[model samples]
Target: MLDFLNDILWGKVLIALLITIGIGFTVASRFVQFRYFGRMFRILGASQAFKHDKHGHLSSFQALLLSVAGRVGGGNIAGVAVAITLGGPGAIFWMWVVGMMGMATSFLECTLAQTYKQAEPDGTYRGGPAHYISRGLGARWNWLAGLYSVLLLVTFGFCFTALQSYAVATSVGDAFGVPVLYSGIALAVIVGMIIFGGVKRIAKVTEVLVPVMAVGYLLVAFVVLGMNLERIPDVITLIVKSAFGLEPMVGGGIGAAILMGVKRGLFSNEAGLGSAPNVAAVAYVPHPANQGIVQAFSVFIDTLVICSATAFIILLSSVYEPGSGVSVEGVALTQSALADHVGDWGRSFVSIALLLFGFSTVLYNYYLGENSLNFFSTDNTRLLNGFRVLIIALVCWGATTDLSTVFGFADVTMGLLALVNLIALLFLFKPGLRIMRDFDRQIAEGIEQPVFDVSRFDDMNLDAAAWEIEPEDLARIRQREAAAVAQGK
Candidate 1:
């Protein structure tokens, strides 16, 4: 029954829905993801020094790191191996395609998350699909919000945590002969210490760890690619031809290639899955679209940069056999490919990388669930505490056991959550577009910094306090605009 449901939800329904929504948002936003690519970096660079916000919001860079922590995980390593094994080299091409389209989807949902965000009692910001669904769509749609929250809680909080833990434990056990039980207990303890510190600690830890892990991984990949520079063209050609079933090596045909690519691509980057926006909304930005654009760049980094690294490593190696009937799945396959290229130490490197990737992912997933739990009952400390304990338990359980069943169940839940989020995104896309336009207009008019004016959204169902501009800052912005206007004249 679980397999059947997963096949229906993820295999059939979601593949089309994810593609269509991605394309729709891309077109609707006039390819904002592409147009603002340079600005994305500018915003990120400008946000490096964390700003102190009285509302307890994270700086934009911290938020970007948080989302990237979730995006670049075991999926980038193990998931890429699985895609190549099943779908052939052509799967990598499809992954790139979905990632490009998913960037736009990410932009839309994250912008909505920022637009409808609200303040929490603890002086932090809270928003996501649920917050936007209830706040943007009005009270009548609160049920949809609740549904999204519940699905998010189940998918990320429980299932994904287990899956991440399992990946780490399995990899470490395979590499070092460590017992899964010990790894599970250690993972649980480490995760508990960070999560218990709350969102601020998670943000701070990821801000440091994400950069180190991602850059280190990419640096190693560059070395490998440099070693195989002559085969780069052949690898690229193989990927493209395999993607369209033009290559005979892609035994499963075009259909399997598309499925594997889209599934793992979405899983790796999480562009349209509605998970990233929960963190995206926690950033303090001059405009809602600022964070959205930052997140769009994250999709690029995850799929095009990190995931491509994994693909290249495998494709450039002799260990990858496209037609072999032997099963080489997940992290083990990745480790084998690296080991083939660089020796036994390569396997140990992969295991260590997986530990960092999985641990950070566990933290991000926990925060997503905690945020959703807050939506149900903000005052229910007892319930929130209970959920945290449950999350820790699930982490340990996942480490000690096989999670094939857990993964299947998570796929179904995640598909439903994505469906709900995509629907909300479609409904609220225009408002997000308006926000983008407003931000663009400011940039075009030579404003170095764009600020959002809540007055522009007076007719909409937004929390005024969320977008309130301080008088002093508002005065400074007006003075700059005035100077720019005079200079134009």
Candidate 2:
């Protein structure tokens, strides 16, 4: 039944919806992701100025890293391997295509998240598809919001966490000869320590660890690519040819490549899957579009950069032969590719990298669950605590479970969550555009830093505590606007 559902959802429905809607969003937003690409870095650099010392609020940069932590996990390593194995080298091309389109999708959804984020009783900001659906649409949609929240809880909290844990366990077992049970137990303990500390702790840890892990993995991938520099063009040609069935390969033809590519690509970057916006809503930014732009860049980093690196490393190595009838070995394929380049130590390096990447993702996924729990009832302490324990146990169990089962369940739930979120985004399309126009208007008027004008959205019933400017901040914004106008900016 799971396989049947996956075939229907991923093979047909999601492929069409993801591509069509992603292209629609890109065109509708006037290519917001591309136009604001450079500004994303500028806004990220300026995050320090908008830092909130508020207990539950995250700085924009921190939120970016947290989202990155969620994105750059097993999917980059094992998932890429699976795509190549099942869809051939051509699958990598489709992955790139979906990733690029996903940036626009991510921007719209995240901006909506910020626009409708609620100020929680504990001074924390909360939002996602659920919040926006309920608040932006109407109380009648509360049921839809609840469905999204539950799907999020199951997908991120249990399925994804277990899948990541499984990746870590398998890699460690393959690389270091560690027992899966021991590794699982240790991972659970380590994860428990950090998750118990809550979102603030997760933010702090990811801000530091995400950069280090991503850079370290990329550096290794670069070294492997450098070793195979002469074959770079050929590899690129192979990917393009295979993607369109011009090249015969192990994963059948163009159809398989498209399926695997879109599936794994979404798994890696999760742009329109409605996960990143949960973390995006926690950020403090002068304009919601500012964070939206920043979040789009993360999709670029996850797939275009990191996932591409993994693809290159595999393609360049003799361990991965195009059209070769080799069974998919998930993370082990990636580890073997590195070993072929750098010997025994390469395996250990990949194992350690997966542990870090997967661990950080575990933290990010847990926070998504917590954020969703906030949607239901923020005061359910006992239930929240029990769920934490449950998550930890799932992580341990994931280490020893069948990879296919874990992935199948995750794919089904992820598809459902994304389907709902995309439908909701379509419904809120006009409001989303209005917000974008407001931001563009500020930018057109020569505002160096566009602050969101809450007044323009008064009828929207957005959370005042989240968007309302304080007296001093409002004064500063007006002064800046005046200065810009005087200088004819």
Candidate 3:
């Protein structure tokens, strides 16, 4: 049964859907991901990203860290390993494609999350699929809302929780020869302590870790690549060729190459999975759209930058070989390739990285689940506590056992989420488009400037008391937009 499910997941149907949606987002957004590429890094580096509210929660960067915590985890490190092993090096290319397009997908979803956000009893704000669906989707056919919540609980909350713990335990077992059980217990304790403070604490942890890990891993990979600089040209050629499925002659064709690239991208960055937006919703950005844009950049950063770096390290390493048996599959394969260059220490290093990535992901996933459950009932405090405790138990369960089943379950769940999220975006598209246009106009006209601060409505309309946006800013942006539209005519 597991074999059959794995076959289906690794086979065409699911792949087609994932690829199609990625392309769909890329096309529908008119390649906004590419058009705005240069700004992503600058936006991330801006001090505004790290600014915080007095009582609301963490800063935008903190929220981003928490979100990155979920995303950049096991996948960036271990998941890359999995893709190359299963789909071939071509899979990494596809992952890049998906990450590129997923920017807009995440932008749309996170904007919607912010757009339809609701205030919680604790005086903090929360929003995601459920909130957006109920608001933009309306209260009428709430059955779909209910179903989405359940899916999130199962996928992001429960099943994924198990998968993350497994990654942690496996990494530890490989690195230090620690028992998986011991790793599981440690993970549970760490998660429990951090999650106790909610998203803020999670964000604090990830904010420190994400950059360190990303940089540390990249430095290691770059060092390896530098040692083999002579082979860099050939590796690049292979990547391009493998991406086109034209080199090794193993794939169906260039079409297969592109298709695989897109598949890996979506799986790696998870733009439209409706997961990242949950974190985005909690971020206090100028406009919901601003958060959306920042998140779009994140997808690019994750798949295109980070994931691609991992692929290069493994492929460029001298010991990399199909025959090496280190990467019998994905993440493991990456570990082996690194070890070939770094010695046995490489395995331990990979394991430690996975541990950080997986635990951070678990923390983020817990919040997602909590938000989903919160939509059902605010009084479910007891339920929420129990849920957290149960997840802790599952952490232990995940570590000791092979994660084939849980990973299978997560794949199915993500597809189901994409369908609902995309549907919500259907209603959300008009508003989203307006903001995209407005933001672009503001930036182009110099009225809004690059940061495009819109934290409150008054910022966009200065006449409005609270979030007073300067009229000069608004008029300048409008005039430019008109001129651009006229030029198009």
Candidate 4:
């Protein structure tokens, strides 16, 4: 049954769905991502007051960490390998396009998640596709929420969880000669210790690990690119050719390449997957949109930055043959590609990084499933404990199973849940538009600096006579709007 389902899951069914949604979102947003491309990173990095609702649990920065943890997980390693293997070099180009467009979709989805977020009995908060879907589309369609929860558990809880374990074990065993079983056991124990502390702890760990892993990994890629710098121009040309249906022969021209790149890129970044929204809810802020923008930056970090690093290393190595040499699979292929040019020891560096990447993902994924389960029931202690146990057990199952099915299963689940999420966004687009305008207006009117501050919101008079925001935020928004009206940005 798993095998049969896995086939349909990864085959055209999910692929078609992903492509359609990516294209649909890009069109609906009027290609706003391109217009906002310059400001996206700049706005996210600007110093602003974060709205921290008195009831909020996590900080805006913490929410980004959680979302980053989920996105930067197993997919960054094995998912990329799978894309290259099946889609050929052209696929990388498509992935980049997807990442670019997906950024807009991510901004929309996360904005809605924040709009519908809930305070919890435990002082923390919970929200995601499930919450926003039901809230936006109306309670009549709550079943969609239930369906999305099940898919999330299967995809995030089992498939990716196990994939992470497997990646870490496989990479560790290859690099350190550690036994796979030992690695798995250690992974389980370490994961339990971290998750026991819950969302805040998970966020803390990811904040530290993500940057180190990302920067460290990028530095290595830069070194390789420097060595093969001469081929940089040719590699870029090839990427463009494959992207535009211009592939020499055995491959499809630029069009197929573009699609392939988008496919893998979306899989890697998961902008519309509705996964990041779960983490975005935990932030300590009054205006939920603060976390939305922060989470949007995560898509940029995962796909635009880290995934780009992997692509550069692989292509720059001039070692990524259509039919490869070592039959390298998963993280091993990635490590081997790095080692080929950098030296044998480079594998160890990647192996360690993969371990942090995978382990952090498991902790954050637990939060995704946990939030869903919370939505399903309130005082069911048994159910909550059962969820934790089930997630852990699935982690073990994923570690030992044949990964082909796991990958397929995850793809299917991700697509299915995202289907319901997309529908929810359609209904909620009105509120989302209103809130974004309000946010931008807040900046334009000089109401507040773009920062998180819950106390400021407690008694806020929306109808205040004078605009109270910081001068800079409002000035920038007006400037951008004026630019848009002038140059049609």
Candidate 5:
């Protein structure tokens, strides 16, 4: 049943839907992801992104880190290897394509997340596809929202967290001869401590770790590629040729490349999966588009930068013959390829990287689950506590057992999660575009920092607390605008 479901959902429905919706969003938004590409860096680097609000909401940068933590995980490494193994070198090219289109999909979904976000009792915010479907599309769509919440909870909150723990335990076991059981126990304990501290702690932990791990892994990749600089051209040529069926290798032709690339790319960056927007909605940005643009850049960092780094490391190695019949799958394939470049120590590096990647992802996934639980029943304290304990237990259990069947089931749920989110995005496309256009209009009018004015969107349902401007802040915005006008004249 799992295989049949996977084949039907992933092999056909999702690929077409994801591509079509992604392209539709890209076109409707006038390629906002590309048009505002440079500004994404400016938004992320601005002091506003780092500033903590009086209400204790997460800084925009912190929310970006949380989203990145979820994105830059084991998939960037082991998953890329699997793509190449099954789909050939051409898969890397298609992954880039998916990442590009996904930027627009991510932008649309996250903007809607912020626009429709609900103010929580504790002063934080909660929203995602579930909130937007119910609020943006109207209460009649509440059933669909509830369905999305359940799918997200099962796919990300529970199953994926266990899989992340398993990846970490497996890597540690391989790298240091430590038992998987021991690693699992240690991971559960550490994860419990951080999670218990709540979302703020998760944000802090990821803020420090995401940059370190991503930069560290990229540095190693650069070194490996530098050592084999002469081979760079050949690898690039191979990827392009294979992508177009010009180079027939391991996984047959263009069809395999497109399939594996889109699959693993979605898994790695999570652009349209609706998971990132859960964290994105938690941010305190002046405008919804600010967080949306920041998140689109994250998809680039995850797939184009981090995942591409892994692909290059593998393809540039002596061990990575296109038709090589060697059965070194997943992380082992990556480790073997790296070992060929930098010696036995290369294997250990991949292991440590995977461990960090997997650990951070668990934290991100746990928060998404928590957020979804809040959507169902915010007052259910006992239920929330039990859910935490359940997650820890699942992590430990997953580490000690083979969950291939369970993981396949997760794939089905994940696909369903994307399906629901993409359909909702289609329903809310015009509203999302209106928000983006408002931001662009502000920029064109010489507003240095765009601020969302809820008054303009009176026809649309929105949480005023999320977008309302204080009088003092409004005064400051006016002063800045006046100064800009005077200077321009």
Candidate 6:
């Protein structure tokens, strides 16, 4: 039943929806993802406008790292291996296509998240598909928001945590002969320590870990690519030719290539699935589009860089056997590829890397659910605390148990979440476009720093408190209002 549902939802319905939305968003936004490609770094380098509230809110860079932490996970390693194994080298080409298109979808969804975010009593911001569905679409659509929140909680909070834990346990067990039970317990404890400290601690930890893990992994990939320099051209040609079914080695045909590419690509980067926006909304940026651009860049980094690294490593190595039905499982395939290239130490290196990737992903999944819980009932501390305990338990269980069924269920829920979010995004498309236009206009007028004016969005259902100006800026604005009042009198 789980496989049937997954086949129907992810294989048929969600794949088309993902591609259509990606293309639609890309066209609608006038390719804002491409236009602001370089500006992403500029916005990321800018100092936080609300540094005083750093404990409660995240800087743009921190939020980018948070989203990246969620994205560059076990999926980048194991998931890529699965795509290549099932769909051949052509799958990598399709993955790149989806990544390119998904960047625009990411930009739109994240901009909407920022525009509709709410300010919490603790000075934190919370928003996502649910927040936008209720707030942007008005009270009548609150049910849709509730549905989205429930699906998000189930998908990320429970299922994905398990999936990530399973990857870590399996990889570590394979490499070190560690018992799954022991690894599961240790995994639970380490996750509990960071999660208990709340989003601030998660942010601090990921901000440091994301750069280190991503760069180190890429460096190793570069070395592998460098060693196989002679095969680079052949590998590139194979990927393109396989993608189009021009290569005889690809038995799955173009349809399978597209399906696996879209499925795993979406899983890896999470561009249009409404997951990243939860974290994206936590950033303190000058303009809502600032975070949007930063997040769009994240898609590039996840697929174009990190995921591509995994693909290249596998493709360049002799361990990858095209058209072989006996290929290794995801993490094992990656381990085998690296080990074949370097040595036995390469397998251990991959195990440690998987642990780090899985750890950060589990942390991210918890926060996504916690944010959903916040949306559901802000005052229900009991429920929130209970949910955290449930999450920790799920983490341990996932580590110890086989998660084939769990992953199937997760895929179905994720599909539903994306459907709900894409519908809401379509409804609220104009506001997102308007917000982007306003930001672009500011940049066009030579504003070195573009700040969002709350008054400009008076007609929209935005939370004023969430977009309130800094103290210094507020004082200056008040003086201008006073001067205008005096002049009118």
Where in model 5 is the C-alpha error above 4 Å? Answer: 47-52, 470-489
For 355-381, candidate 5 gives per-residue lDDT tens digits of 999999999999999988888888988
- Reference-based lDDT, each prediction: 0.87, 0.88, 0.70, 0.68, 0.88, 0.87
Q: lDDT per residue, candidate 6, 90-166, as tens digits?
A: 99999999899889989999999999999887777899888888989999999999999999999999999999999
TM-score of 5: 0.96
Clashing residue pairs in candidate 2 (N, C-alpha, C atoms within 3 angstroms): none
Residues 1-489, candidate 3: write the lDDT tens digits: 654654454455556554565566567667776776776555455425334444455445666777777788777877776666555566666676667657777877886776666655554677787777776666784787788888888988988899888878877887788999998998898888877677777777888888887788778878887788898787767666677666664344455455446545666687877888888877654455567767877786788778877888777765455323342555677777788887988888888778777877898889999988987998887898898898888898988988886786777776677667767766767666656776677666753333334443332221112122335444554565467578778
TM-scores of the candidates in the order shown: 0.95, 0.96, 0.85, 0.84, 0.96, 0.95
lDDT of 4 by residue, 1-489 (tens): 655654454445555655565566557655545545565454444323333334435666667767887788667776676566555566776777677767777877887777666656555566788887776666787888889888887777666788788878877888998988788877887887777676667777887887887788788878888888788888777666666656555144454454446556766788777888877755554455555566667888888778877777766664576434336655767777888888988789888888888888888778887777778886777776777777677666666666876666666677677666766666666666655655666666744434333334333212111112345544654555566567753
Q: Could you tell me the lDDT of residue 28 within candidate 5?
A: 83
TM-score of 6: 0.95
Instruction: Name model 2 segments beyond 4 Å from true.
Output: 54-56, 470-489
Q: What digit string (tens of lDDT, one per residue) describes model 2 on residues 1-489? A: 999999998898888878777898889889998999998877876677556554546878999999999999999988899899989999999999999999988998999999999876666788988999999989999999999999999999988888888889988998888999899999999889988898888989998899999999999988988888899999999999999999864577999999999999998999878999999998877789888899999999999999999999889988888876664468889888888899979889989999999999999999999888989997888988998999899989999988787678888999999889988988988888888888898888767788886777888979888875546545665675577678884
Off by over 4 Å in 1: 48-50, 325-327, 471-489
State in Å the error of residue 258, model 4.
Answer: 5.2
Global fold similarity of model 3 (TM-score): 0.85
In order of listing, the candidates' clash counts read: 1, 0, 21, 36, 0, 1
- Could you tell me the lDDT of residue 340 within candidate 6? 89
Better of 1 and 4 by lDDT: 1
